[model samples]
Target: MFSEDPGARIEEVFRRIQEERMAGLPFINPALSVAAVGFARHGADWRGVLLTPWGIQLLLLPAVADWPVPPLLTRAFRQYPAGTFAFLPNHEKELGDYLACPLISDMHPFADQQTALATARACLIALDIPPVRSEAQPAAPASDGRRRFLGLDG
Candidate 1:
């Protein structure tokens, strides 16, 4: 059962997790709060970054109600415009079945929430950009006489 406001639902779920399970953890950043960043419909799912006290993650929730749930702890690969990413299937009673790909597993390095949010946004933008592919090209003969004299020509 996907909520009408998935971002708010996600925040609520994590905030509760933080209170019940993650309190007093050394890796939890005090400056960060549970937030869903840049959530929008991507293909058949809602894709976004989720910032929590413990880490930042890229989450994919079903846009439609009939989405099938994968077995818990199973790994799933999702194709974005940029590349393929491996996600772990998870289910929350509040958010239902979703896929999570951890972008940052440690929140200790983030000095403030703003920085973490910015990084999350950047990750979302990066997912839409195709990776650059490098191709090998034959080297051209050195045109400069100085290069030939110095034996620098390839």
Candidate 2:
């Protein structure tokens, strides 16, 4: 169910989580979901992103993580572990739309094909992945005539 390609893995994870959310499953941490979006956009480098319930709750509120904990709190409550959060990266501009109005309440933010495809394209662009032209010719002729019959000659 997994792929060796980093981009493919990230995309798969994002789609699976989206499906679970749409089905009303009690899976996917909000922070993880957002982080997954970032990974799906940015690729393998951001795979380490994660979000604890406490961390997300604190971030949503007006209160700062240090307000109560100070030095006593060993962990950085607002800060995600390493690459767990996507907002920390420089690709904020590419993801600003999604980040600004995320599906904080909606279960299937990415269930819409248009939204998912656009987001994936944005991610690939952010990661400098070149777009493959659908009109590009195949290197060899197909042995089967189905493609020609279907008029998908390219």
Candidate 3:
């Protein structure tokens, strides 16, 4: 299992999902949700790279306004002028060091939650991340006498 290698596991997950997608299988929601959770969980390890409905946002924790821009961000800016959130890692006098700052200067609003999630998923694909199997759905509600206490017995 790729889980054994935390660093590479994320990529493996994205690759599998992308492969399945190319094969013409129906797209699944939970698969992308899992990817989002993974990104949320491990984003810091990847230099705070983040996905949003509008585009990618590089969150600079303990912000440095004058942070040196990386080539990846420069390209992202060109590709998504209103979408790239950028902050180059630098040490020339700390700026905006008190808070985490979004790098994108402009953004297009998502139509809704679903749209945002879908875009996030696409961003993962664009970035070459693989998806993993979905987690088990929550258990069904109990159907015993206790239902009356919860007002569901009506």
Candidate 4:
């Protein structure tokens, strides 16, 4: 299934691996990140912003079980639209949260075009900083619904 969307393809590969290792097939949950994001410590941040009705369903459904994301991005997906979002992990981890960073083109450690494209397509709802030309843009409708969170808890 590896096609032009190498990143997406790779994500699928890793997901299958995870599913196999879990002793059973993967459930229908579009878990948007790595095994760590699913972990109790990171799941909340990863599931932060993009918790829409459809987004929620995609994430929790077995048909769309797609995650395997980068750790730094765990914060970015906090607000992206779940259905339209994608979190791409660099094949190389030494690069770390660097992102080859779309906004900072020259700042890349390794090219890894596929991974770069994947990073570009991640679930970023918004950012205090933007990616490179690439061109600056934002999703049409917010992943969030009626109201936004002020981060205050009762």
Candidate 5:
């Protein structure tokens, strides 16, 4: 529904959740607040990071109108530049259908909001990097390179 600015809408929705449901929870970090980071159009979806007191997640919200909502509690896989990741389907009354790939499930490790925000941004950067592929190398003979490299051949 928020085709123009889905990130702002997401922040608002989670802010409400923070106030109504997450307050005083033991696992939530008090220093962190709800935020949407690096949101931009990605094909037919808006991709970004959602930072909250409880966790940090990579969010994918539909950009098109009338996008179908997947069944709740089901996992969906989406491909990013980094790699394919599993996202959980969820719907918010205000935010509508979206997918979330949790990057950090515990916020307690972060000392402050800035540190958490930095981590969220770093995650976005990491997601943009393509996964590395290594070529296989032939194994060296045990008595040859292995012993020589260790200077034990003599």
Candidate 6:
């Protein structure tokens, strides 16, 4: 109901929760945590979140600089294992470059350990190797004609 009438939807949700609270109901926390992070030698934090229907119960706090202790975001960041992390603007090249850096712990957004490992492996592979000669290797074509005279390859 957040489309045509956002106020009504918010009111309804609040009213339902209020009723549930009055009845001493338990809220099933509905949300999923997806993370996009940037990292440096020193620190990092989550850039965005992945949410599920139940997980939306999370009322996120502002960044730590502005917010008080016991912040929701603090808890979320803490939930992640201590290691590489950051909140970056969405850009694959930049993220890939960051991933390639040697100091990063390199675990990324995948829920599966293997998948995260794969990203690290891929990044490392990219950095360690030269680009493949996709356009065919440069050859001494008997002359530096730049372009073959009507393609002498025939």
| Model 4 per-residue lDDT at 70 | 55
Q: Model 3: clashing residue pairs?
A: 13-130, 13-131, 14-129, 14-130, 14-131, 15-130, 68-88, 85-103, 85-104, 86-103
Candidate 5 lDDT over 1-154, as tens digits, reads 4557687888899999999998899999998899999998877778899999999888988988875567888877766565567778988888778998777778888899899888889888877675443577444343242233223435
lDDT, each prediction:
0.78, 0.28, 0.32, 0.28, 0.78, 0.26
lDDT of 5: 0.78
Model 2 Cα displacement at 122 (Å)?
4.8
Predicted structure 2, TM vs. truth: 0.22
Runs with alpha carbons beyond 4 Å of true place in candidate 4 = 1-3, 25-74, 77-154
Give the worst 10-residue stretch by lDDT in candidate 5: 142-151
Model 4, CA-based lDDT? 0.28
Q: Which candidate do you rate higher for lDDT, 1 or 2?
A: 1
Query: In terms of TM-score, how similar is model 5 to the real structure?
Result: 0.83
lDDT string, candidate 2, 52-129, tens digits: 211111111112222222232133222222112112211122221112111123324444434544543443233232
**How many backbone clashes are present in model 2?**
3
Per residue, candidate 4 scores C-alpha lDDT tens digits across 13-115 of 4445445553333332333332211211123222212111112111211112243345653523333222223333343332122112122222133234444
Off by over 4 Å in 6: 1-111, 135-154
lDDT of 5 at 119: 86
User: Candidate 1 — what's its lDDT?
Assistant: 0.78
Candidate 1's residue-wise lDDT over 1-154, tens digit each? 4545489889989999999999999999998899999888876688899999898889999988786667878777776656567778898887778999887878888999899999889888877765443577543332322232223445
Instruction: Show model 2 residue runs off by greater than 4 Å.
Output: 1-4, 24-154
